[model samples]
Target: MKLRAYLLMLAVVGIWGCTFVLIKDALSDASPLAFNTVRMTLAFLVLAIAYRRHWREINRHQLIAGVIVGFFLAAGYQFQTAGLAKTTPSKSAFITGLVVVLVPLFSTVKALRPVGARAPRWNAYLGAFLAFAGILLLTVPAGSGVLPDFNAVNSGDLLTFGCSVAFTLHCIALGHTSPRIAFQPLALLQIGFCALFMMISTPILEHPQMRVTPRLILALAIAAVLATAAAFSIQSWAQSILPATHTALILTLEPVFAWITSFLFLGERMGLRPASGAIIILAGIAITELIPQPHVPTSHEA
Candidate 1:
């Protein structure tokens, strides 16, 4: 069970990590909102068909929870897809992985969650710290020594930063919701909300049009089916089996996968300073997860 959970988390992060490049490719023909809408809409249909007869699968509350979750997913992806057009997928991936860092921080928010629950462990705190350090290494530039020319104020980077923030919030929100809801219904409703909002947001933000090219079609199918649909399913399954901290730790490598994919497939180059910065960030994340844990006393000890 432990091995299966570990592999499941690995597969989820690996597949999700590479999606930025796919998004970049898919956006060549479709606008961000249009792209999101199509992906969610198609994924909705596919899942819906499978669960069509399973009305008893989810209650009304779960459906509502799913839709609410979907909205956050759409918001995060909308900015992320838009940002990927400007920044390299590798950088975006790392920046995006900051969600792991944000999860612990957000969990403490007075409004985000009840303080009644057991607090996260010291290792979780360290993971958040390492994750934040990695973000600084990658995103901050004025004195970071990585990109002298790296415009810290670039509109594109800021947009990607927005992506990071929204995604972080979404992941944190998932940490709360996933534990309570049934996975299938939650996923189905989540994407349904994403499709609805993105379909509307696309027209307001960008011209809603797509040129049907082989590459674009391929990209859309891959993202919608593989990344969005399959990835969501896998995440839901993995989250059910693994601790949330472990899931975040594994996902911390998302940027590494993104960086590698772009370097090999898209030939997006990261200069030495920035590349080293990414490595620093990744090292921090790994350490955050792999650090030893302190023993907890049982009731009998008292």
Candidate 2:
């Protein structure tokens, strides 16, 4: 069961990785808020139609929780899409990948504060550090076979970092909220609320408009159906059985996949450094999950 849940999340990561190019393309024709509003609304409408029979099962608590969770979800995508407009896909990916570190820190702090959660295992920390380094290599342009221009950091990097933080909160929120409610209904409500929030905020914040072009429609369909609806459903159901730290570690592969997709579709060259970085990211995941800590005897033991 645990293995299946991990695999499910891996699939979600794959779907999300492909979305980077699509989103980057879509944002050229529409504002971030406008694009997100339509993407999420389309996702919500599909789920609502499919699960209309279960709408009555959602309670007040679930409705409220879903809305709260949806805010973070929307904020994450909003910041990510907005940032993608100003940054390269690889740079945006690496910056947003910081959640691998944020999730464990958030979990560790929460555990220390008498929150009933245990501190993250040591392997999780190691994995997060390794993944962060891998992402750095995978995303940054090479100079002298290692490292990129640190001065390349800009407003887009900062915004994508905000996206990372928001996504980390979303994962943590799911860890707390998913087990208490039906996954489908909660996911529906969450997507619905996200769409509503984006719709309400788009006009106030930006000049919102969407062209009804075929390319735009295609991107929206893929994002709304595959990335938003299916991915959220998988994540919500999987988090019920996995820790947020573990989930974050697995998701660090997003940049690796993003790089691969770009190389294939966008004709971006994948050099040796990024190839090594991808291997390291996979190793980190393996070390975190496949490793076993040494057993320490308690005082009562012989």
Name the best candidate (by lDDT).
2
Q: How would you encode candidate 2's per-residue C-alpha lDDT over 256-294 as one tens digit per residue? A: 777677778777665797667656656665555443322
Clashes of each: 0, 0
Q: How many residue pairs in model 2 have overlapping backbones?
A: 0
lDDT score for residue 57 of model 1: 77
Superposing all C-alpha atoms, what RMSD in Å does each candidate have to the true structure?
6.2, 7.2
Q: Report lDDT (CA) for all predictions.
A: 0.68, 0.71
- TM-score of candidate 2 against the unseen true structure: 0.78
TM-score of each model, in listed order = 0.84, 0.78
Error (Å) of candidate 1 at residue 135 is: 3.1
Looking at model 1, the pairs that clash are none
Where in model 1 is the C-alpha error above 4 Å?
A: 114-116, 120-130, 140-152, 287-302
